[model samples]
Each structure stands twice: as C-alpha cells, then as structure tokens.
Target: MIANKSLSRLMAHVTPGRLLSLGFVLVALTGAQAQETAAPPPLAGGSQDEIKQFCTNIADAARDQRYLLQKQDLDKLQTEVNDRITVLEKRKTEYEDWLKKRNDFMKQAEAGLVDIYKTMKADSAAPQLQETNPILAAAIIMKLPAKQSGLIMAEMDPKKAGVIAAIMASAADPLTSKDPS
Candidate 1:
C-alpha cells in the first residue's frame, strides 16, 4: 500500500509554477531524444570514399594545370631566345658579307686609280691633282715616277704645289724624312 503521508507531501510541492517548469524540462529532454534517434538525409556527394577521391582528383588537376602553365612559359621563353639568336646570327653573316664587299671594292678602286694615273698624261694628271684634296694629291704624286711627279707639281699653282709637298713630307717614312730624328 502507498504511504499517504509521503504522497501528500509530494502533491503539496507540485504548485502551478513548478508544474509548468517541469513540463518544459520534460519537453526539452524528449526533443533531444527524438533528434538523436532520427536519421539525416543523405548528401548528394554519396559515400565518404567517393568524396575523398573527388577531392584528390581536384587537387591533382590543379597541380597538373600549374605544371602545364610553367611548361608553356618555359617553351615561350625558349622560343623567344631562339628567335633572338637567329636574328643575331643573320646580322653577323650580313656584316661579314658587307665587310668582304667593302674590301673588294677598295681593291678595285686602288687598281683603277693606278691604271688611270699610269695612262694619264702629266698635264692631265696635274689638273686632276690640283682639283683633288692636298692629302690625296700628295699620295697619288708620291706613287708616280719622280719625273712624272715633278712635271705634275710644276703645272699646279705654286701655293697648291707647296701644300701638296708639305703633306707628302709629313707622310714620308720616319727613317727617310728630312727630320733629323
């Protein structure tokens, strides 16, 4: 049989305010229990292994993309370097060809000058010498025979002859010069 005294004591403590608070506590505990027993909807990504594999694939793809970009940059740089080298090589070849042509032209001009002067009359040579610069006239006169050079100089104006003579003297071999040293 129930103890009426203990039951009466318990009933006395269950006031309206205490009853509402007890109801709230019971509701909170049941709500937690319900949530614990329930299953959440499955994710669209499927199993944990699949999601892990997908993440691994994404990481691998990013790494491969970076590598490919670096490779492309290197290839572009290499192409630029190769193009520059080709241009420089072409320029070097052109310069060598130009130098060779210049040397050939100089030889031809020297030969032509010698042939013309050798065939030219002293009178004709004199007028040409007077028209040319003193330095060039001196060089041409120096290449002629002593008799021919004298005839050419005699035909030149006295002032022009003096200038040409001075240029020739200055260009003479040091050992053969009028200078004592």
Candidate 2:
C-alpha cells in the first residue's frame, strides 16, 4: 500500500544527526523572530532637530541618487526624482505655515507694544508729571520699538536715557537679574 511505502521512506531518513540539526535550525529561527519583534533604539536627537535633520538627509540622499542615473535609465530616475521633489515641497509648505503663525503672533505683540509706547510718550511729554519709579521707566523703555528706542536714545539726553537703558537691559538679561538676598 502507498501508506506503508511512505512510512518506510520517512523512517529511513529519521537519523539522529538530521533530527538534531532540524531542531537547532528551528530554535535559531525562533530566536531571530524574537529579535525582529524587539523595539528599535530611541533616536538621539530631540523632535525639532530630528525633523530638520531627517528632511535635510532625505534631500541630500535624493540628490545623490539622482546623480547616479544613466542616460538609458532616465525615465526610471525621473519618477524617483519627482517623488523626492514632492516630499521636499510638502516639508517646505509645513515650515512656511509655521513661520506665518509665528509672524502673526509677533504682529499682535508688536501692536500691543505700540499702544504702550504711545501712552509712555504722552506721559513723558506732559509738563508737570514725574514718574518716580525706576521700574516704570524701565518698563516704558522696554516696550518701545527697537528702532524707536534707538531714535529716542539719540534725541534725549544721554545720561537720563542711559539710566533707563541700564534698567531695561538688566531686565532683559536673565543672568543679570537680581538675586534675593
């Protein structure tokens, strides 16, 4: 019978050496699968820096890959090159959107700065009023637009502007701020 012949053939190949080799191979394959399922190492760079570096590297790799194309391979390379360009374009658009948002926030901040400058200008222009607080003067100097601050420094007496400038400068520098005694 076919079954009796098949059993005889299977028994003929079941040597002790072959069985051990098969078992070793099975264990090795399982070990390899376990390694494959293990988590990848964490990235060394932080988020923003990592994104920037990844984009730069992708652009560079694409450039390098393009240069390796032959005249006969032009069509194949063209598709690849186009795909790279599309990716770069998307990254550029995302960066532009972020920049626009940042600019909008800055614009709002600058407008508020202008309002504060206007009030300070009016108060400082008055005849009899005197601002006694150095902190108030420092705040006023700090709020002035950078160009306006430069112009005011040029227009006013150097000694008075210098004092206010020193206070504002101190307030700006985190390292220079006063420590509690």
Candidate 3:
C-alpha cells in the first residue's frame, strides 16, 4: 500500500502519455518474466518422445535377437545335415570297397579251380573232388570239357556225382554251354 501510494505520487508529476507508456512497459516486463518461468503444457498422448524412443529401442533389440536365434538354428541344422551327408558318403565308400574285395576273392577262387582242373588228370581230379567241398568240386568239373566232366562224374560216388551233375546242368544255358544233344 505504501509502495502504491509512492508510485501514484510519482505518476502525478509525470505527463499522462509518459505515465501510460511506463505502465505498459512494466506490464510487458512482468508478462515476459512469467512466460520465462512458466512450464510448458504436457502432451495429450502417453509419456512423449522418451517413452516412444525407449519402445523403439526395445523393439529393435528384440528383432536383432530373433534374427540371431534364427541364424543359430540354421547353422546348427546345416552342421547336422553336413555331418549326415559325410557319414553316408563314408559308408558308401566302405561298401564299395567291400564289394570290390568280394569280387576279387571270387575271381581268384574261380581261376584257382580252372588251373587245378587243367593240370590234373580226370581220375586224380575226381578222387580229389570227392574229398573236397561238393560246391567247389562241381565248379571245377564245370570248367572242363563235357567229355572230361562225364568221365570225372562217372568216377565220383553216385550221390556226389548227382550233386555235381545238377550244379553243372544249372550253370549251362544256350549262352554258356555247347550242344550236348
């Protein structure tokens, strides 16, 4: 109240225009100070940019993690597939090697029988054939000419001769045997 009375006394001495201008200037300064101190209004939406940015960051992290997980799964699957293929390939190679050895053994056995039949006389070979494996003896007799094989078969025991004759007959065909009729 005292300050207002002092301002009124000072204004009374001043011209009307100057006093009005001073009052306007004071009002403008007070408004400027109020604006400077006042806080800005809050947004209508949730929290604002900070929360949105945090959500975006979280989403990005989730996406990156998902991609990494997929890559890890794919890598594991690929390794398993490669391992299976390698195992199958190795097994195939071993099987092929076994087949080659079996074929080599069969060829050598056949060649040995052929040599034995060719070197020995029918009487000697027939006695030996009767002593050895029936299947092996039949195979040797089959390598000889029909006449020679007949002589050897005649010398063998009847049951053994029948077995050899049966094997020889089964082995013969139009493609492999000469006309005996």
Q: Which ranges of candidate 2 are over 4 A from the true structure?
A: 1-72, 121-151, 155-181
Ranking of models by TM-score: 3, 1, 2
| Model 2 pairs in collision | none
For each predicted model, how many residue pairs clash, with residues at least 3 apart or on different chains?
A: 0, 0, 0
lDDT of 1 at 59: 99
- Each prediction's TM-score versus the true structure: 0.39, 0.31, 0.43
Model 1: how far residue 115 lies from native, Å: 1.8
Q: Predict model 1's lDDT versus the native.
A: 0.85
Q: Which pairs clash (backbone N, Cα, C closer than 3 Å) in model 1?
A: none
Candidates' lDDT values, in order?
0.85, 0.69, 0.84
Q: How close is candidate 1 to the true structure, as a TM-score?
A: 0.39
Report the C-alpha lDDT of model 3 over 152-181, residue by residue, as the tens digit: 888888988888777777777557555432
Candidate 3 backbone collisions, by pair: none
Which consecutive 10 residues in model 3 have the weakest lDDT in total?
A: 172-181
Best by lDDT: 1
